[model samples]
Target: MPVSVLLVEDDEVIRRSVALALERYGYGVTTAEDGLTGLELFREGRYDLLLLDVMLPGLDGIGLCRRIRETSTDPVLMMSARGDALDVVSGLEAGADDYVVKPVDTSVLVARIRSLLRRTTFRPDPAPDPPPDTAPDGPAPLVFGDLSIDTGGLEVFRAGRPVALAPTELRLLLEFAAHPGIVLERQTLLRNVWDYGWDGDSRVVDLCVQRLRKKIGAERIETVRGFGYKLRR
Candidate 1:
């Protein structure tokens, strides 16, 4: 089946153009002219991904993203007319999986959509069961407030309920939880969590941290001025 995409934009021209492009690329497209209608369609339909414009009538994209995060784990690619760094950061902080500046290149937009979908869709293979005696000496589960990180099962629980987390978010959380209260520089985080080479840009760390904050709560991660970040112990 074709991948279904929800295209939410207030501009009639941009909306129709994007919807046509996505349809041409074998995506089954659903469109909404405003945030309220977009969100309503979202609740009623099963879409593989969401293409949301930052500026919209009723609720803005950032606010809509937050609302969607409250209940849905589906990947979101945010579109914005503003191309500033702050704009991108704000979108990421609002729980977007990726951001694309407006006056968009349809080709680049398609590539980004593919990339975000790929990352969100990936599921790592489960590790083989360890021997019974190999269990750690202390607590059976590592606790972080109401959240539990199960090293053995590679799963996370919040108040005894399972929380759906993306693979990247899960790995980043585990790394921070392993060294609670210790600040990790962006470079170190990128190398360890993303396995990226030193030459790669550190913005990957920022994006992942934003995603993690959305899941675990922003107050749970502390930022050290001009340094990096740490998970609150």
Candidate 2:
């Protein structure tokens, strides 16, 4: 089945254009003119992803993302005309998996959508040996002190309790946990985690790291001032 997308944008021109472009890419898209209508559509339909605009009527995109996140783990990609760091950071903190600035190319937007969706779905990949005494062939879930990461299951736990993470957060953690103690440069993180082909703004990575650290504990992910981040082994 084609991937389904719920597009919520208040601007008619952008909304219509994006919906058309997404349709051309063979995605099943449902468009809403406002956040309240989008929320209603979300409740009435099943979608694989949500393309939300940050500025919306009635309920804003940030609040709407939070509401959907309360029940759904579906990927949410927020779009905004605002270039302010605070605007983008607010959206991410509100449960959006990713954000895109407005006037974005349709192709790039599609790529972002694909990247987010791809991270949520599992595929075969190599892993290090499981902890001693665990299965050697099938890499066991990563255990670092109190934090537990089930790469296969795409779940996380801290202190024996489940931790709910946005798709981006989980993907970032997987990269960090995969190579414990190794510093990952900002450029490397952008390409690997965000799938940005070019050297993108590092602020996105920084904000994500901060949020991930907040949930998984601040001390585990260490910053090597002026370099990058690494997971403490």
Candidate 3:
């Protein structure tokens, strides 16, 4: 089955062009001309991904993202006419998984959609979860003080309470937890956690980190002064 995508853009041209491109690439595309109608369709229908334009009539993309995030952790990709740092950061902060500068490249957009979907999809019956512990017994789940990460299960727990994490957040946590005490450079994190290459969109890492900190606690993931970040061992 083709992946379902809800594309909301204010511009008629961009909307039609993107919807056509996505359909050609074997995607099930649904489009909305404004944020109000977009949010309505989103609430009414089921979709695998959301492609939203930052500027819109009625509510904006950021607002829509926030509203959807309140109930679902589905993947959201935002686009802005101006590739400004503020716009990208704001989009991420509003719970968007990724952002694209407008006049989007169809190939790149497809690739981004693929990556986002892969990250967001959860596996069924995740390896039956090993005994929860940080024992160095070769391939045990990672434990940090009060936090527990079932690497095999791809689940996280804090103080025995389940920590709900988005796909990017979980992947980022896995990266840091896998190499406790080792500082990961921004570029390295971007390449590992995102489809971005080189120093591409380091703020994506930062925004993800910020959200992770809010869920897992700030004192756990330490910033390595101009270097990057490391999970406290």
Candidate 2, residues 149-182, lDDT tens digits: the string is: 9877778999999998877788899999989999
Candidate 3 error regions (>4 Å): 122-140
The Cα local distance difference test for each model comes to 0.80, 0.89, 0.88
**Poorest stretch of ten by lDDT in candidate 3:** 121-130
What is the C-alpha lDDT profile of model 3 across 119-177, one tens digit per residue? 67755343444476744343467899999998767789999999998888988898898
Error of 3 at 90 (Å): 1.1
Q: After superposition, how far is residue 174 of candidate 2 from its true place, in Å?
A: 1.0
Candidate 1 on 100-141: residue-level lDDT in tens?
A: 789998887887777666655545555666678786343367
Model 2: CA > 4 A from native: 126-137
Using all chains and alpha carbons, the TM-scores for the candidates as numbered come to 0.71, 0.90, 0.90
Ranking by lDDT, best first? 2, 3, 1
* Per-residue error (Å), model 2, residue 25: 1.1
RMSD of 3: 3.8
For candidate 3, the lDDT comes to 0.88
